[model samples]
Target chain A: AQSVTQLDSQVPVFEEAPVELRCNYSSSVSVYLFWYVQYPNQGLQLLLKYLSGSTLVKGINGFEAEFNKSQTSFHLRKPSVHISDTAEYFCAVQGSNYKLTFGKGTLLTVNP
Target chain B: GAGVSQSPSNKVTEKGKDVELRCDPISGHTALYWYRQSLGQGLEFLIYFQGNSAPDKSGLPSDRFSAERTGGSVSTLTIQRTQQEDSAVYLCASSLGGPSGGYTFGSGTRLTVV
Candidate 1:
């Protein structure tokens, strides 16, 4: 079985500032990682995914994540954020059975 | 028609009542999944249907939770004698059939047990 852990429950940052949402996972086998974002009262939208290849994966809305195999981490990062970037972000891991395990999520608040 | 669709968008049911949530997967999608998101919590997998294979019910919390997919296109999640803990947003998603293909999620049905 696979599991995901999001270190921070909430992150507050100023507009134009950078932010990083930490995520870690546990699995006995290789896994695929993904980041999804959800705005208020909306469904989740894929931010980016790390299936293989380059460790650094870029996603929509200027978001990117780096997959660190040794640390078992796939942290989402943004160079500069806007107020609209505020949302709840989820980290998910897909194991061999193709089941996705998700972390509790991190609430990002970008303020002006 | 183009994306996964779930309804009714919001459902309020009394305790001990039975509720059914519907999901219509995208045309030609071979994999469908059900997940529950509690308030301030992440998504919890409930079940998944792939092709004609047996549906994966391992993630179901208890016998009170059951689901079925019809004709490989639509799915329904039924909760019998719902409890307060059953209150959550039930999300439905569909994919081309693998982790690499990713998934398209519906807006979800908010089930509120009173």
Candidate 2:
């Protein structure tokens, strides 16, 4: 079984400020990590994914995440944030069995 | 033509009524999934269908929830005896299977039980 833990429920940051959303996972088997963002009344959209190879992976909308095998973490980061970046983000892990497990989610609120 | 599509963007039904939500996955997609998202929360997996094989219903919250995929493309999720607690945005996503590519999602159906 695989489980994701997104430590923060909400994060508020000023415009153009760097921010990081923490995520950790627990799995006994090999895992694939992902980050998804959802706007109000919209469906979830994939921000990025970490399948294999390099530990650091870049994603759309100026976002990036690093896969840490030892730490069991895949934290999302952005050099700077804008008002448009305010949304709900979810961290997920797909286990060896192909079941996708998601964390509770973190809400990013960027204020101008 | 390129993305997953969902129908009946909004639905309002009586508490005991049954409702059906539809999803049209991307063309040639072999894996389809259903999920539910309540206000201020993340998505909860409901079921998954891969090709013509049996769907994984392990995430279904109860027997009242059921889903079916025909022609390995479109899928319909039915909720019987809908309750207030059942009101949420039902989301549908499609992927090529495996972990390589990210899943594409539809706009989702907002179900409101009155």
Candidate 3:
């Protein structure tokens, strides 16, 4: 069984400031990691994923995440954020088969 | 190209009524998935459809929740005797059936059970 933990429930940052959303997972077997963003009333959009062969993954909107196997973490980062970047970010783990376990999301609130 | 599409963008139903939500995956995609998102919560996997095989129904909350895919393209999620707890944004996504391929999502159907 796999489970994801998002350490923060909400994060508020000023526009143009750097931010990191923390995510950690627990799994006994090798797993695939993903980050998804959801705007209000919209479905989840894939921000990035780590399948294999890369520890650092870059995604759309200048977002990136690092997959740290030893620490069981896949943390998302962005050097500068925009007000449009405010959304709910989710961390997901896909273990054995295609079933994905998602963490309680972290809401990013970027203020101008 | 058109992205994954879901019909009836919003639904308001009385308690104990049955509701059906529809999803149309992108062309040539073989894997389809259904998920639910409640207020201020993460997605909860509802079911999956891959080709002609039986769907992975493990995520359905109860017997009232059911889904079916036709012609390997369009899928429908039906909730029988809907309860207040069934109200949520039901999202649908499709992928290329690869371990690394990311999914394309639809706008989702916001079902409100009154």
Per-residue lDDT of model 1, residues A73-99, tens digit only:
999999999999999999999987888
Q: After superposing candidate 2, which stretches have Cα over 4 Å from the reference? A: none
Interface RMSD of 2: 1.4
Please tell me how candidate 3 rates in CAPRI terms: medium
RMSD score of candidate 1 (Å): 0.8
Which residue window of length 10 is worst by lDDT in model 1 chain B?
B95-104
When sorted by DockQ, best at the front, the candidate numbers are 1, 2, 3
Worst 10-residue lDDT window, candidate 2 chain B = B35-44
lDDT of 2 by residue, A1-112 (tens): 8889999999999999999999999998899999999898888899999999999999999999999998999999999999999999999999865668889899999999
Q: What share of the true interface contacts does each candidate keep?
A: 0.65, 0.72, 0.68
Per-model lDDT: 0.95, 0.93, 0.93
In order, what DockQ does each candidate have?
0.77, 0.73, 0.71
Candidate 3 lDDT at A16 equals 99
For model 1, give the TM-score of chain B.
Answer: 0.97
Any runs in candidate 3 off by more than 4 Å, and if so which?
none
Work out the TM-score per prediction.
0.98, 0.98, 0.97
lDDT by residue (B1-114, candidate 1, tens digit) is 988899999999999999999999999999999999997768999999999999999989999999999999999999999999999999999988988877889999999999
TM-score of 3: 0.97
Which clashing pairs does model 2 show?
none
Cα misplacement distance, residue B89 of candidate 3 (Å) = 0.5
